[model samples]
Target: MTSEGTFCLVLHSHLPWLPHHGSWPVGEEWLYQAWAHSYLPVVELLRRFAGEGRRDVLTLGVTPVLAAQLDDPYSLRTFHEWLGHWQLRALHASTLWRGQPVLRELGAAEHRAALHATEDLETQWRHGFSPILRSLVDAATIELIGGPLTHPFQPLLDERIRAFALRSGLDDTGLRIGHRPAGIWAPECGYAPGMEDGYAAAGVERFLVDGPSLRGDTSAARTVGSSDVVCFGRDLEVTYRVWSPKAGYPGHANYRDFHTWAHEVGMKPSRVTGHQVAPPDKAPYEPALAADTLRLHVKDFVDTVVTRLRRLRARNGKEALVVAAYDTELFGHWWHEGPAWLDGILRALPEAGVRVTTLRGALEAGHLGPPVDLPASSWGSGKDWRVWDGEQVADMVEDNAALQRRLLAVRPGPLRDPVLDLAVNEAMLALSSDWAFMVTKDSAADYARRRARVHTERFGAVLRGERPLPLEDRVFGQLDARLL
Candidate 1:
């Protein structure tokens, strides 16, 4: 049934700086996988919708670091090479697994996926992502959401540094996307009291927070504390319906199993046949079964949104707004069928009589309410800051706080020092909330700790007035030359 309320989908797209980082299990390979399986397919899907005249069907947060990587000349070259390697790996897999019918079929599917990604890259993404992404923003197919330069958790950052990060990030967005964004994803939806003022000063008119931030009263957009900037709380009820930390749609039995990777090529080759099934015992993936499952989940999600909005309108006696946010990488990167599902949902929502709007569009439509005081929060465990600051990551917290103080104290001269500029860049990367999150979750904990240390040590060296490390000098010199 039709409802007067609106539903907004916010896709928060972000990845840490990975150009010079390691590859394989993590690093540049991570970037390539997301680019091929997630970004390419997702953007192409959005383009298809735009062809049919869809506008603002969803909101997208493409963090500045991610944007830089997509636009970088070095990244473009390496990504092309990575795509070639992917196809080669698939070809080898198809040949090597010939005796095993199921494995051979899996290899063939991966080969087709690789070829498709290569073709998309050549036709649409050959030049760079800036122009294509800008076109979408121009067409209003999506509203761009900017965030801090390196996805720093603004809540814990020093006030001035936080402001600089936000302002610099917005400026970068303007440079790359042809306009400054009016909204931001706020780096993990992490919020501290009075951050509304920081966002306001940076000219960001709106942001998102966890539903608990608004005390779960997300019936309408809200102005926080004393600031006029609007805040939209992510409705956990709707978001978790698709994917949550512990469980969600991607775990459906018919979907591709992410954990059962092929030893030779590291490609996933099995379906999530059952929760208790061993990787070796899991059934082979079947596209037909997955297609059927996708339809069911899509309908279930659309129906859920309709029912929730209808109930919310009835309870409020007014038009209500619901925002469902997620990481953009989840689509093809983690869930093999994610892009198709997204394409289906975007088309079905409007047909089902549900209104699709960007968070900015919602506010402009006047779906707003009085100011509310928000509690310090994040879209993390316990709906608070524990994941980034709890016992597991206490050392990281101390190191980040120390580095922020040191970096802020040493302002760069008007004439840029390549050393200082590079140091500042590293410091920003070090402060990324991803490190602490990985540590807390025990996922890639060692890599996370090492990355945190390397950046901080580089930042510390520069702060101590020491010369840039040898490797730093060579790397930053090349980057400096490119800027000129």
Candidate 2:
């Protein structure tokens, strides 16, 4: 049977640099959790697909900042230690909760998972993510995407700073993965009218934006502002099936609940029994039940894509493109059954007469639409810059503007100036979009504010020579101030 339009799944993986910072609740803990649950499993799954001779399964974006940490010696050692601790905690849970049958079962399940993850990390991820990612890229199993350093909100960034960050970020990816990707996730799918000029200059041929950014006509990738740079807008209708603030597949009663905590052992032991169910009243998480629910959701998602493509083809008179993008962390980290669901969907799509490919593959197959004069937008609230620039974050916006101005004033030359380069790095770190997004969402708002302010203060201290450059903040080691 002939296939419908192509389905491109783009997973944006990112975390602000966290080493030498706090650990618990919001720092390295955040990175390790995503690493253990999402990165480890997702990459392993891709390797399995590659072993099966799959090519161009999906597009994976790894921000330069996170890439650095994944490959950093400090991060590697710490992550291994973290995994060991995870195993110990799971064992402790199993011992402490043995009196309660339900909690004991959950504890035993967690221990098994933690043990498997530890072995996976010690074997496949021993060196770092670079080797594993490079092998997959070389095998043509996935198209890797790179994004700006620190994952700054580009639409709000100074043009010079934005251009420098994008180029440096691409270069960083090339250094780590041995391939500089032509596609980017565009830091929150944030875009401004002329950002494509910078993208084109940096050799970025394609990028992503929110569905509403392209006015919800995401049936095809559109070239922005006459540049050859293509903007692939997310098909919200398709993506929201798996993830959305209000509700999604993860909320299924059979799936493990992300919020319910087993405080003593630091594990989630409950299923999402009911939305309004108290945490203590939530049912114990049953892996087999979640697996059954995952199968159903996967089938539903495949059907959704089939129906969407048929509708789009009828309307557009062609096999249009349907792009569904999400944060890679959403998989095993936030949604415990996500990786399994992903595996099922990827395998099921082709069987259902749907062509699954990367964004680059879709474009090469002639999925391009007419050029669009894209307005300033982001994938944030309102599909505008409000989340980063609203009255609620006016102070942050102003502070970022001031930092950029100070950075530009330094105007360091092509020759590397240790002080100046470190200053630029600090400035970029402060400009990360995660901080404002967290503040607006009230998720670790205090930590986010502190991180931003600390980086900003360090930027000033470096410029004044009041603070010596620390080895800990050496994320962008090759960052040249001249790039700005």
Candidate 3:
């Protein structure tokens, strides 16, 4: 049977650099948790698909900052240790909470998962994530996407810094992955009108934008402005079916509740029994029930895509493109059953007469549409740049602008100064979009502010030669300060 239209699942995998940083509430702990729950499992699933000869299964964006950490020696050692600790914690949960049968079972499950993850890390991920990711790319199982250093909000970034960051980022990815990607998941999908020129200059063949940025007609990829660079807008109607803040399959009653945790065990043992159900009142999580719910949601999502594609074809008189982009951390991390659900969807889509492919694959399959001049937009609140540049974050926006100026002023001539490079690194870290987004959403706003301020202070101290450049802060070792 003929397929309806192409389905492109773009997963943006990113986390601000966190290796010498703090832990627990929000830091390396964030990285370790996501690494265990999401990255490890997601990559494993992709490897499984590749073993089955699946090619171009999805488009994956790995920010340069996160990639650096994944491949960093410190991160590799620490992550391994963290996995061991995870196993210990799970064992503690089982023994410490023996009185609670549900807790004991959950603890045992977690222990097994931790043990497997530790073994996987010791073997496949021993070197770092680069080798594993490169293997996937080499096998043509996934199309890798690259992004700027530190995941800065490009639309608000100074032109010189933005271009430098983009180029350096692409080069960094090439260094790690054996080739630079032609596509990128623009930081936060934040884009301004003329940014496509920068993308074109950097050799980026395609990028992603919010659905509203293209005026909601995301039937296919569109060339932006006069640049040959194509932009694929997320089909919110399709993407939101699986994940939206207010409602989504992840919030199903039978699924594990992300918020309800056993504080003593440091594990979540409750199901999302009800939306308003207090954490203490929520029912114990049952993996079997969650698996059943996952199967149902996977079927529903496939049906939704089929119906949407049929309607789009009828309206446009052609097989349209449906791009569902999401944070890679959503799988297994935010949604416990997400990895399994992903496996089911990938297997089911092809059987249901749906063509699953990467954005590059879709483009190659002739998914291009008319050119568009997109407005300043993002995949944030109101589909605008407010989340990163809102009133609540006005101070941060101003500080970022000042930091960019300082960085440009101190731009190295031809000589490579380690201090200057470190300064530039600090500046980029300060400009990360995560801090602003966290502040705006109040999701660890204090930590966000502290991190931003610390980076800014470090940038100043390095410039003034007030502090010695630490060997540990050596990320982007290939970064040439003259680029700024």
lDDT winner between candidates 2 and 3: 3
Query: Where's the lowest-lDDT run of ten residues in candidate 3?
Result: 411-420
Give the candidate number with the greatest lDDT.
Answer: 3
Off by over 4 Å in 2: none
Clash count for each candidate, listed in order shown: 0, 0, 0
lDDT of each: 0.85, 0.91, 0.92
TM-score of 1: 0.94
Q: On a 0 to 100 scale, what is the lDDT of residue 11 in model 3?
A: 97
Question: Using Cα atoms with residue i matched to residue i, what is each candidate's TM-score against the true structure?
Answer: 0.94, 0.98, 0.98
**lDDT (Cα) of model 1:** 0.85
RMSD of 1: 2.9
Q: How do all the candidates rank in terms of TM-score, highest first?
A: 3, 2, 1
Off by over 4 Å in 1: 1-4, 99-103, 463-484
